[model samples]
Target: TQRYAITIKRSRSDINDEIKNMTLGCNRSGYYRNRLNLTENSRHRQTSSKLLNCLFKLFASRCNNTWSFEVRNSEHNYQPSKDMSVNRMAAAGSCPHQILSTIHLNDLSLMAISKTIYNELYSIRQERLDSRTPIQALLNELQGSDFEFEYQ
Candidate 1:
């Protein structure tokens, strides 16, 4: 079931902001992130970041639009867990480290999306402490390379 609420928080906020506060964004590009909940934060941050990268690639390849999103001020701390979200997020290219990488490509779409922003909570920064984020795998794959990506 979907639920909604309106609360006065001393400071003003809109529905979008309210939704952001209620849960970690389905995607990382948003005003604020739910920082306290490590389980949800990593779960969302990793999956959402990978998903953003996926979307960026999908759009860049099919269309010529330049997609970009700002980076969050803070970073995520990765800890090993037995949680189901971990495996799902891993498949989606969500890693704590290796947030960004030099693709060494001149394509406008990739170039625009790779450009970094400051003082924001937009997309995740790539820090590849882990083996490979989904972005790297996707980027390296040949066009039309088929692979299975899933969650749960």
Candidate 2:
């Protein structure tokens, strides 16, 4: 199975303010290391890993409010998962520590850990945008009003 990560490279932008570019890459597309780090004196256990250091990736750029995408590599060493959505849920929680046990027992990547954190932040951002607070409702109603006020 395969997973992916979304990475963004941004700079101070006069128009968009940020988000200069973005990338999507296979989560397993990197150096392979024996995470077990088994010492000579330590008891050995059979361990297996699915990581293949695949190089599949895509890139995107923004220009004048338009976005363009390009694929850097079209092939993967590992077979694609039958259900990509299942991989999306692989790191669905807010805390990396919550999955530490899984990481120790398996060959999970750091990209999956970061995906969990990003999911949390994205959920929070969506919640705030969809908030039903009375003040927020009032602001929504006043969005195109003729008055402007400074707000943090």
Candidate 3:
């Protein structure tokens, strides 16, 4: 006599819902496993924040239009409303110290990168100041008057 065995497999949507439910349960729990999961989520959040910061810096340097540094659709839903306000104040040249304080340095590695970039910008500003040549003057000299200005 021969016997047949049956196997069961969960659907993709079912698996996804299972994961979402598990994450929600872990978030509510205070066990070590839950803490570890939370730590991993925080790390992911930090990485995303750093990426957004770098992208914003690159875009701000190249594009004329303003870019809002808001993180949407994040796993943890960590928003930086206070940071945005501080950045706005800094842009207006009102609060310098608060601007530095507003930046979130959750990951040490990304924090180092942020510090390095900030130092480089500071050095460039210092050189500009020492040479008594403003950045606008240098840029104007580099690009001749033949370049037409476009108004949107």
Highest TM-score, which number? Answer: 2
Predicted structure 2: clash tally: 0
TM-score for all predictions? 0.13, 0.40, 0.19
**Quick one: ranking by lDDT, best first?**
2, 3, 1
lDDT of 3 by residue, 20-95 (tens): 1111111111212334556654665553222221111111111233332322212322232221233344446644
Positional deviation of 70 in candidate 3, in angstroms? 39
**In candidate 2, which residue ranges exceed 4 Å CA deviation?**
1-17, 34-50, 84-152
The segments of candidate 3 whose C-alpha lies over 4 angstroms from its true place after superposition are 1-90, 105-132, 135-152
Model 1: worst 10 consecutive residues (lDDT sum): 53-62
Best by lDDT: 2
- lDDT head-to-head 1 vs 3, winner: 3
Mind giving the per-residue lDDT tens digits that candidate 1 earns over 65-151?
Answer: 333323222232222111122223344665422222322222222211222212111222334313566766565553446865543
Q: Which stretches of candidate 1 lie over 4 Å from their true place?
A: 1-64, 78-152
The sequence of per-residue lDDT tens digits that candidate 2 reaches over residues 1-152 is 34454344323344546676777676666675756677556737554444567877788777877988898887877654322232234347424454434544454333333455456556655666676775776677677687776555
- How many pairs of residues collide in model 1? 10
Local distance difference test scores for all models = 0.30, 0.56, 0.34
